[model samples]
Target: SFRFFQLDPDWISCLIDGAFSVGRVTAADAAADQKLHQKHVAGKQPPVVSGFLLRSYAVKGWPKLQVDGYKQTAQDEADMDGYKLKILRLAHLSPNVLLCLFEGDAVAVDIHQKPEMLHLGFEIPDTKTPDNYSKNLRKADGTDKDNYKNPWAIESIQPDPATRVVKVSQLFLDIEKKAALNFTAPFTSAQFALSMVEGVQKVRFVRSGS
Candidate 1:
C-alpha cells in the first residue's frame, strides 16, 4: 500500500528550513500524446517514471539500505516491493548541484494502473536511542536491528555509498590516452618503430627506380 524512502539525517534541518524542495522526475509526455494514451488504456499500463532517489555528492556521508528482518510472504502480497536502483550523476552548469554518479543496473518503476489513487507513505529513520536501549547501542543496532537484543529502539537506515562499482573499461581507456601523451612504455616503442619502416620503404623505392 505504501513505500519507504531513506534520507540522510543531516539534511533534516536544511529541509525543514526550506533550503530546497524535492522534485520528481516524471515522464515528459506531450499533452496530446497523454490524451491519446489514456483513450487506449487497457489491461496493461505503460511504464512511467514515478520519481528518482536523490543523493548529494557534496555531503561527505555514506548511503545504505538494509533489510532488518526476513519474513516469508507471497510476492503478490506487496503492492510495490523494494528493489535496487542505479546511481546516475546529473550534469548541471551550477556548482551548487550535486554530481552523484553510479554504474550498475538501472531500476524501473512498476506501471501502476492508478498510482495517484493509491495511498502514499514517507518515513525518515529515527536514529535517537530510545529509553530502553543504551546510547552506545544506537549506531550498531540501527543497522542490525533484528539481531540486536534491544526491543525499544526502531531500526534506522544508516547512510552508505550506493555506487560500489568502478567503470574499469572507461578507466583503462583514459589511462591509455594519458600514458601515450606522457610517453609511458609501449607507445614509445610504436612511435619510433614507424620511422624505421618508412626509411626502409624509401630506400627500396629508390633502388627500384634506379
Candidate 2:
C-alpha cells in the first residue's frame, strides 16, 4: 500500500544538501489514525485525517542511515543556521512522486498571499543498514547533536511485482494568489529559508503514489 509523509522544509533542505542525519517521530505522527481508531471504538470524537503513525507505518529493517556526498551552496549554508528545523522519517511506502504544500499567510483584511518558499529534490544513496547502526547513532560528533533521538533514513521497497524503483519526478514551489488580485513576485529558496527562520508558519511536505 502507498502512504504519505509530511516533513519540515528544513529537513527537506538537509535532504537536498546531504547533511541531514535525523528524523523525528512522535505521538502526533499517528494523531489522525489514532483519533479515527478512537472514534470507531467509542464514537466519541470526530475522525481526523493526519499522516500515518510512525510506529505502525515503518517498514521492517528500516530507519537506516548512510552518508551521501550532498552539498549545499554557500548562500544556503549562511542562511540555514537561523531556522529551527526538525528531522523526520517515514518508512514502508515507496513514494513515486513528491509534492510540497505551502500554506499562504493572511496578508490583509480580504487578501491572502503566498509566503516565500523553495522546492528542491535530489536522489540519495539506496537505503542500507550500517554495521554500527546503533553505535554510530549513539556517538555524539558535535555536528549531529540530535542523532540519538531521531531516525535518519527511510526504507522503501516494491510492494508488488511491477514496481521497480521509487523516485521523485517533480519539485517546485506552490503559491496561492487571489483570483481577483494580480500580484507577481518571485521568491528564492534562501528567502524562504530566512522566512522559516523568522517564524513564518504553514509549510509542509505532501507525498503521493506514482
Which candidate comes out best when scored by lDDT?
Answer: 1
State each model's CA lDDT, in order: 0.28, 0.27
lDDT for each residue of candidate 1 in 38-120, tens digit (9 for 90 to 100): 46642232222122233334222321211111111224525223433344333332332223222322223221122233221
- In model 1, the Cα lDDT at residue 5 comes to 29
- Candidate 2 pairs with clashing backbones: 23-87, 23-88, 24-87, 24-88
- TM-score, per-candidate, Cα-based: 0.16, 0.15
**How well does model 2 score by local distance difference test?**
0.27
RMSD of 1: 28.4
